[model samples]
Target chain A: MQSARADAAARLADMGLPGRRDEYWRWTNPAPFMAEAVPEAGAFRADTPIFADMPKVRLVFTDGVFDAAASDDPRLAGVEIARLADAPQWAGAFYGSLEASGQAPVRRPFAALNTARASDGVMLRVTGRAARPVHISYRQSSDTSEAILHHCVKLEEGAELTLLETGTAAARANLVLEVDVGAGARFHHIRPQGRSHGHRVYSAIFARISAGALFKSFTLSMNGRLTRNEAMIEIVGDNALAHIAGAALGDGADGDFHHDDTVFITHGAEGGESRQVFKKVLRHGATGIFQGKILVQPGAQKTDGYQISQALMLDDLCQFLAKPELEIYADDVKCSHGSTTGAIDETALFYLRSRGVPREEAVSLLVLSFLADAIAEIDDEAIAAEILARLQDWLARHRG
Target chain B: MLEIKNLHVKLQEEEKVILKGVNLHVGAGQVHAIMGPNGSGKSTLSYVLSGREGYEVTAGSATLLGQDLLALDPEERAAAGLFLAFQYPVEIPGVGNMVFLRTALNAQRKARNEPEVSAGEFLKLVREKAKTLKIDAEMLKRPVNVGFSGGEKKRNEILQMAVLEPRMCVLDETDSGLDVDAMKLVADGVNALRDAGRSFLVITHYQRLLDHIAPDVVHIMADGRIIRTGGPDLALEVEKNGYADLLAGVL
Candidate 1:
């Protein structure tokens, strides 16, 4: 473990920090993250816990440091679990493995930095269906704390597991999650970051899926000063499925709010299906960016790839930027990509208002309707309900 | 139920006059038909009464049950019991028809300081109303007016009217794109909603629609003014001799 850490540190030193001159960081500036200093953010308060109704194994982290007193034992999850620092020999091959594979053709310097510096995280290996979900709660109570977390998960053949990451991590957070899905296994990830006004967040997910495996991930984010999310997925075996979705609402009424999602998906085997759906509602000078690509290598036949990113701007002050790319080396594949930025339909608004809905309420309905496509990707009914409620709550307080 | 006095309006962008000193009155329990040619300001009147934007009411007053209608927003006017069945119903892509109806009904109820209808009650009410218009369950679950045919859209407008139960309703060319069977079905739906306290302003280009809706009074509008007003016979004369001849007689 220590040897892998030293290798990652040396690799980070060679690559250095990201800058605005880089193609990936042009739309979103990297100045706030390049220095050795951690930026300041206001602390957040929540009235209720997310996913409060579900049975789960909970791990609590306050300002990047794990709190044993506030968390449930990982053994209660009915899965093999250990702290990342104290992980057994099985974790050595999977810790930085997928993240290193994702570095080629693209370099996420922050992810490498996280691998080198993260002090504490969780390692879970699921051999059978887990009795309960593993919920990682990043609860923050500090205004200037910086957190670096590196978590890894491995699912054995015919295994099933669900992992959830929620709450505001810290004033500044760099998180990296590496996952390996064995044959005939399934993995689900649902993360809804808590809103903090001045926070800066950078997170990445790297996964390798085997044949006959299923992987689904959804994220919901609303309030943050700056956020960048990157996802790199590889379907190395036939008959695998991968779905990634995100919904973000940017409110720049205060000062600055920008969110970016950059995704890359590769198909290496036949009969693989992948989809990417991302939607954002921006208002009052906020900005949203999307850079997504799908790659089908030789002999990867019968691959179905779909990507859509749309932004509904409430006013003229907001803007959206997108770059959608599709690369194919096989002739027997179907792939489509689309991106659009538009304002609320005036005619539709008048129709709603004429039917007795107030302007604010009508606007909220339309915004939610815009996000419905992305939210529909979640397969769990209970989880989708909780997300819908939070989305409604956001729209109510955002009415201006 | 609705009174318009010296209502003058113009296109906000072009500054061109559309409604020139239009005056009309619709009494409770009565059905009035306004017949006119294209660009005669017939549609503008409905839009102005419903408080749609881009129309400047330079002068005039529209009162609903003695309350000023022009002073309120469009939604407020709706809460005040005014409804307009659009000439071309707008299509909302992601809002289900059932959800839209319930939201509209509940919103009006809440605005009027009444208790909201529960989901079960709303569902029962909508199914009852939707069945009368020949709208099936699939149509109710689909997005509002999205992928619906022309006749389906018009019927959806009537379904909304029935559910909202407004006091004064304006049918703006609701018979424009309907076949005979669809027209009769829609006419029956409108007829079912008529009562002693509800009034209707039926604006159409042909008298054939009036034959089914059976207006008590008919008015001929030309160049943004009501040129003639009489009993139902006036619509027949206009339909027979055409608006050019009627304008000649009035001028």
Candidate 2:
């Protein structure tokens, strides 16, 4: 194991940061983060936390370090929280195992690097249904700050949890989250990346599900200099279900902003189901990319999988690139994937205008419609509505 | 309430002329029907009046209630009491029908410096108008025009017309995709909204719609020109003898 770690560190050092030549990094060049000196983070004051109204246990992280004095009590009913350095034996077992297992068939050097340098993150274990959600908020304090956070989560049998994450961590951030869902357990994740234009974020989620486990994740990415979010999910037990969805918006004019969503789901057990839905709205020379795939193993009969990635480009200068793939080794499995990129439907726009809707409002309506499908994937209505309001604000400010 | 003089229009992308030297006038409280064969520019005339894009008006003057309709944007024209019922209503998958109607009503009201309608008031108004058109609450709750049948689409358009209550309404082939029952339902909806303060321009390829709507005046349009103007009898004459004889006589 020590030799493997050394090998991984050496490989990451040799590869340095991902470049345009990397297959998955072709559309998004990671050269900005590869510089020897990280850029200064502009000072920002977040108006309010995303789920300020929601009754949740809050954990605050400042400059990649846990801020215990500013957070809720570590003790809560049916839930256990521990800082990575002081986590229990059971929690430490899952800290890096799942993430390491995910680096197969495809190499994510950023994730590997994140594991090597992660300073601090939370370890959460749900023994039973959590009475309230767990909210993690990140706050940056330094201009040239760099944050590496790796979170490990484990849900015992029949346990349920909802995790809400928000805020910008730093000027440059590398995040890895690993989850283990036991039999008959359910896990819900909702993350609204702060609308900060100066941050460069590379994040990944590695999740594994057992029999009859349910896992759903929804991510909303607003404006950022460069953001690449990767998710890898494995349904390892029969009758397990997993769904991953994202909605992103990029409205930068100088061509310095880009957002990418890359996801892979594997069905290794019978009767497993998985779904991936991603939508992006780009304008003013901003770029968006989606690369998603579903794999059904040989014995994974009765596997049901679906994947769709679509983009609504608000102008000709904006670009959207998508690659959807499905691989089935079982004869009785059902799998499908589709990708589409288009402008706002002109006919719909004309209809709205003819009905007395102004051009700007009409465009806003169309943009919301384009994102409705992905937003619907969020399980919590209140959270979904909040995210929707944030998206509307973004649209209003970036209207052409 | 609507007037056009020597209207000449051409496709924006192509050099072909659509409406050439056409003149027509519709009086207040009057229902005028324009009958023509395919490729005769009936739809083009309606589009031009509603301020649709992709058309260049080379020579024309159009007025709605003494306002220069051509100078206004589509939404402005709508706010200025002009409405066009599309032959094919657009389907917006996420915008609710009720939301769309309320937004439109409030938008026009705001443009005219009138107070915006309250949600309760708007709902009551929509329910009342939709009841006349047989549009149920369920249909109103669905996305605009999505999954609606052809008959339902036409009725929705009429419901919109009733809710908007514009001074000048243009119907472009509203009868094309309707059965006898649906056509009568639509006609009834249109008739209920008729008043001395409003006028209508109903464009159709056949005279069937005129029979139900009872136009006060009928005109024969061909080759991008209104060759003949007559009373309601002209519609019946063309309906029976067909445009073949009318074209022959004109030639």
Question: DockQ for each candidate?
Answer: 0.67, 0.75
Give me the displacement of residue A388 in model 2, in angstroms.
1.5
The lDDT of model 2 is 0.89
TM-score of chain A of each: 0.98, 0.95
Report the C-alpha lDDT of model 2 over A64-94, residue by residue, as the tens digit.
8899898988777888988878877887556
TM-score of each: 0.94, 0.95
lDDT of 2 at B15: 100
Clashing pairs in 1: none
What lDDT score belongs to each candidate, Candidate 1 first? Answer: 0.90, 0.89
> Which sections of candidate 2 miss by over 4 Å?
A1-19, A43-49, A73-76
On DockQ, the candidate that comes out on top is 2
Docking class of 2: medium
